[model samples]
Target chain A: MTHQQIRGVYSAATTPLNADNTPDLGLFTGHCQRLLKEGCHGVALLGTTGEANSFSSAERRQILEAALKSGLSGDQLMPGTGVAAIPETIELTRHALSVGVSRVVMLPPFYYKGVSDDGLFAAYAQIIETIADDRLRVVLYHIPQVSGVPLTLPLIGRLIKAFPHTVVGIKDSAGDFANMQALVTAFPGFSVLAGADPLLLPLIKAGGAGCITATSNLVADSLRIVYDHANDQARAADVEAAQVRINAYRSLSNSYVQIPTIKAMVGLKTGIASWARPRPPLMALSAAEHADLATKFAQLP
Target chain B: MTHQQIRGVYSAATTPLNADNTPDLGLFTGHCQRLLKEGCHGVALLGTTGEANSFSSAERRQILEAALKSGLSGDQLMPGTGVAAIPETIELTRHALSVGVSRVVMLPPFYYKGVSDDGLFAAYAQIIETIADDRLRVVLYHIPQVSGVPLTLPLIGRLIKAFPHTVVGIKDSAGDFANMQALVTAFPGFSVLAGADPLLLPLIKAGGAGCITATSNLVADSLRIVYDHANDQARAADVEAAQVRINAYRSLSNSYVQIPTIKAMVGLKTGIASWARPRPPLMALSAAEHADLATKFAQLP
Candidate 1:
């Protein structure tokens, strides 16, 4: 599909870790259904917010299975399965492809720093060669700030040129619009996704695909409207206003806490569950932080 | 056991990837045996140099099995089992513990940046509590520059105090002597190993433990001698000379290629393998870089 043709808001759903800290399969399915019903084009589970890195391969498979059980097919899901290791990444990606999850968003191996573009190319090359499955559609995940492993413009362009069909798109979560524009300008039809919710309209206007945003976990429907009417001059004010509101909220509390905070807002609004508990090392939001987040979110249009 | 204890040079061996790129188990065992004979304290298999992040759980198990088959016990080996996810970290840590591999170094869940120490504490706390196994001895792998997840002083203090027994030590690859000193001073009995080879004397004089170093992969015997004789002025000078020699060699080439370059040099010296193939996204050293590295090594004492 072309870049413009691939436009639609994608909710990067939060993977609910249970009280005992296992993958809460039941809650995950409910969340997926809610997102789909709210009109999100698809759900990208296991992104940074989904805590994909914190899950085991078996656990990853189980979550993917649970999402499937909820009737979210390959088209409705793009699972995060990339790892620092090649074998594990290939194993997860292959399994994802087998379960009809053709579209996989992969983070580059980010453990080692100062790696060259040549090295990045080698990693992607090895995966495409090993999978050898025509059904697999890889979306290069570019979240350089966190991954420390960047998907540069040249590297993205090279991958697209080498394996046009396999590497169909990219999710630019670098939060840098200049880089996003370069991708949009460089690869005409390649789906260049805006990973930041705030950049949805500008990115779409720059000939890019929709966003797979973290905040969309809370405000997905509004994000969907923003994506659907991205080019509408009449709605530009509303879109810019909403983006500003979300950005303001993110600036206060740790944006890394956005996952649990989004889930907290979801619980407040829809009643799937109460007490949004993020797994430790990442604590549940404090009363003050939550109260603050809720007050600001209450201000959302 | 004590703060004054746990001193020696530990080699983080490289897992030799075969021509087909499958982990060469035989070469792995051969390297381990050679390291043990070289008078090294233990063999740290599947570390960054070993490309721990590049292997599957099954592959990691196989390498561990081969090390055992070649006569290394669990206590004699420290495996790098940290994943970007908690469950995988638990699985690998549990497996290592089950196999009697007690000393498992863990990297923080690194896909997200600016992660609150509370989030990191949550990750480590969950692993320790859930495992509920007494045999587990945790070593925090602090390589912030690589993982983008820094294990801050306060976080370390919290983890040590909370799970005193389970949180055994830390390998500070930050390469900052002051940070290493703070860790040494704070946790009285904690094993604070320096990640940088050159910091051994300063660390040891400061009541630090042994080094979990990459360069030891090439020169374990010399590093061991230096580490053992750190107290003696004459022997310390010899050690300092060797450190200078090794550091000169490392500095000549692109420091980015340190892991593969060191592995290649080891392979060259031992003749057990022809090439040091780091996993994808990390290519082999270029011919010019390789020659420069070789020239610098020849000049080492």
Candidate 2:
């Protein structure tokens, strides 16, 4: 755990939007607080589930600012600052630091596919160097399914070697445990956070750090229970039960288009209908789907 | 031809960078002027070939503004305004409109993959409605290889039908002639511009509206000749010869990583080595690759 710079069940919090589709800042910050109250270590705001890419840079800055202004300490937040372009990624990361948030989850410059490792390394190096700050802690984001950019082992190693203190962790959302295991094996002390909910227990047991996941948006308490006592022999039954609950929430969330469904589930969890509204390119679930989900959601552990 | 809204051999011009990697505004503008003088209908600056996605929004605006300031008319500069973020795309497009430029090659919001046609439709529809500029003409960019988001035919049809005047054309860079043919067959009046160089002749003959291609950066005259005389029975040999010349340049460029090699070849063509510098996430050719390419480039038509 010496290299466990970021260790906990951090919620990849889904953003709550108003009827006009703008981010409902008040609702979003309240949800962040609830995740914390329920045992989330930190709030990974502005992630895939949060629909960060759909919003403008100004909105992204405002969302992070709003979360901070809501009284969440900087260390309790890890915002995704990576984007298709390098300058904006740098700007977003700097913006996070300017507001006292030091840790950031960054995706690679994802516009070009099949880019050489040299090219990717150069992009990251240039960005990190340009935003030269000793306090910066970057958790590389590897979600090839969504971003079309996979942060490879060699690239991660290069980043770690170049900026050992700055580049601390990774959010392995590729949903591959083998990859996470390999990352743990390769880089000791470098945090390996699970991007999926179900893997958090196994990953933590396997010398991995923790998780920054979507299901945590709904079942943070269960995840926190699992994380707190996964290794406790006397609490083995509790761990198993919490895991089942987390899986139930994850399964229901994945039953529809994942992000929108998670937002809807959040609405059902909090009894707030506006929580169901996702921005464009991610539609709100239809009435029939919502009813079906509500039935299944009620039956969860 | 009758339904052609955007018809011409528009060079997807390669942007040259200075030593510090800033857009060499002077060289870029000169390249645009040269592209026009060499028979290109317009300079499609800040495109895939131009490495538009690599630059920040501010940089993209500056490059486009530099072209317009260098005496290129608004009609002769089709900058790529679309990005993964819709608001920035809207802002960039609006900026273009404000400067008297109407047409922009817009890529779909590309961060999320396997998104539904409905979601994508909503994204573009919302952006267009938000812009709400009558002078705005968007040429939908469809390069699935580079931009993971594909502008499917159904989606394109919906866009054209929804905003008949604003949604004017498509840059079909999937390198699939069959898809281009289907688009031409399905949407008669919508501009179906070839993304590849060799397809220009066949696409034009098959009733497509010219091209917006990378090779046009190197061999604009040949592409211009092919477009101007594809239907002229007397100029059949000229078109064939021009197409052959165009293919030669394309093949050499493709021999290496396409964009950087094209930038390097542009350096060779203009005898300014500075043209070889590409922004990060896109590397310059090694000295050896450049030397080999230079030798072969000298032998090209």
Candidate 3:
């Protein structure tokens, strides 16, 4: 498969669900429009950042349909459809492909750890064979620390070899620069998208395609500018410095609060004052946290 | 609210599925009969050890129904029905209660970690309110290292105080002896079961009711003997030695292969090699591991 359109900063936008906790189609549509307007190269809907697995199959289909209807083209959209079960993941991926999403990021069947690479390969093989979509662009999502399922080089090599056309890239959210660089270097033709915003410049310089980061939720435009001017040394250093401060805060709060903190920043900047309503099971920041975030974000350049 | 029945060895058995991956109802029936014959107090089905989360809701219902049909009474079974989503978990749990399985082990909504106890309370509250089953006896399953979600004492105190009648007990699988002792000491009346097989003696000596252990899959009879013969110092030491051998093997294998490894041991003892087949994403061990286990088993008391 040719590495043609998989480059630059791709924003994994949050799915704005309605008050009923269903996909807020209107808000999602508006968010996509705003993301594109704010200068993201493309958008990845229903990712961890987008909380894709939180929605059921029907809700997922509905969200995708609304995205297409709202002028979000497939060429610019990569939706997360990974599930614990292969059938469900395939069903979701097939739907995405049918709707013209050439690139689909996938999470490994993550419930089990220390799982054999063969099992993961079998899963991918089953999915690829079942879908049989020629335009299928599989980007393996590697967030081991969260999923407890790590996508190693041997597994990646196997998938890419078997479905060379289908498996074109990986999203290294391991948050380890060494792993990110290894991915870029190991898979020459494959697009290795950095999952952290801070590593964007280093990864790009190390032959990475670009980044699909969480903090991109609040800083899409700034990240896009960084991606565009990465070759310019002075500007690149400044971008890294800003990201260092941001990541320092992320480390303090625990990266699990990335979405909420980003949303808090978004509300602060836009004056919308949204409550940073993380779904139940993932608690929303307390009042003190909200106030602290606002004050801290105010100090960011 | 009085703790009556939860004081003995409970084996969280694996559901032996057929080649088609459907529940092997016949195998399970036989398995249950054997466990009862061997003198286990009760059996916990669809637990993390049983890959409960991997099975669909329909599968869980079917398995529970089969167990009921096979003469396992409500008092003799504890089904694990917790998932990431509250509504689905509630639905499945309510079904278990209705079908006469009053004792249900509930895992915390574990996918999202670093969540506040308030969120956990809301989740449990929703389940209790929706089910409204007077017979409901909830045993909170605490295995934070795997689930990425921890159940702190404050949350436990709040739940027990608020729903004294419903929140009957907890299975402290944190594997930390101090934490388990704290739970046993703090909730004097509440049934605190040891989650670790190795800690069974210590926990029992410290006011714990019994153990809900994964290793009970292979050594239920021995565990039962030890529990019944707790006063015999030499016998308890023998049982502890056997448990250490099993647990050491478990730790050496990283605990990821605990289910399959135990099943392999069962297969070796019963001459039912089909029992070794673990579900996809969890492959069966190779010949080398089988040989190693055989050598280790010979050294066991």
Using DockQ as the measure, which candidate wins? 2
- The candidate, 1 or 3, that scores higher on TM-score is 1
Off by more than 4 A, model 1: A1-5, A233-256, A272-275, B1-5, B234-237, B244-256
So what's the TM-score on candidate 1? 0.94
What's the distance in Å from true for residue B46, model 1?
1.9
TM-score of each: 0.94, 0.99, 0.87
lDDT of 3 by residue, A1-301 (tens): 3453478888877766455455668867887888889888888887877766555566788888898999989998888878766656778898998888878889887666677898788777877887897988898999887777899998998898998888988888888999977877777889889888778878877778988877776677777776777777768676766566646544433433766666566567667554366556655677898887777677765
The top-ranked prediction according to lDDT is: 2
Restricting to chain A, the TM-score for each candidate equals 0.91, 0.99, 0.92
Name the regions of candidate 2 deviating beyond 4 angstroms. Answer: none
Q: What is the per-residue lDDT of model 3 for residues B202-243, given as tens digits with 9 covering 90 to 100?
A: 777777788887777677776776566666776867766656
TM-score of 3: 0.87
Candidate 2 chain B lDDT trough over 10 residues, lowest sum = B1-10
Return whichever of 1 and 2 wins on lDDT.
2
Query: Individual DockQ of the candidates?
Result: 0.77, 0.87, 0.36
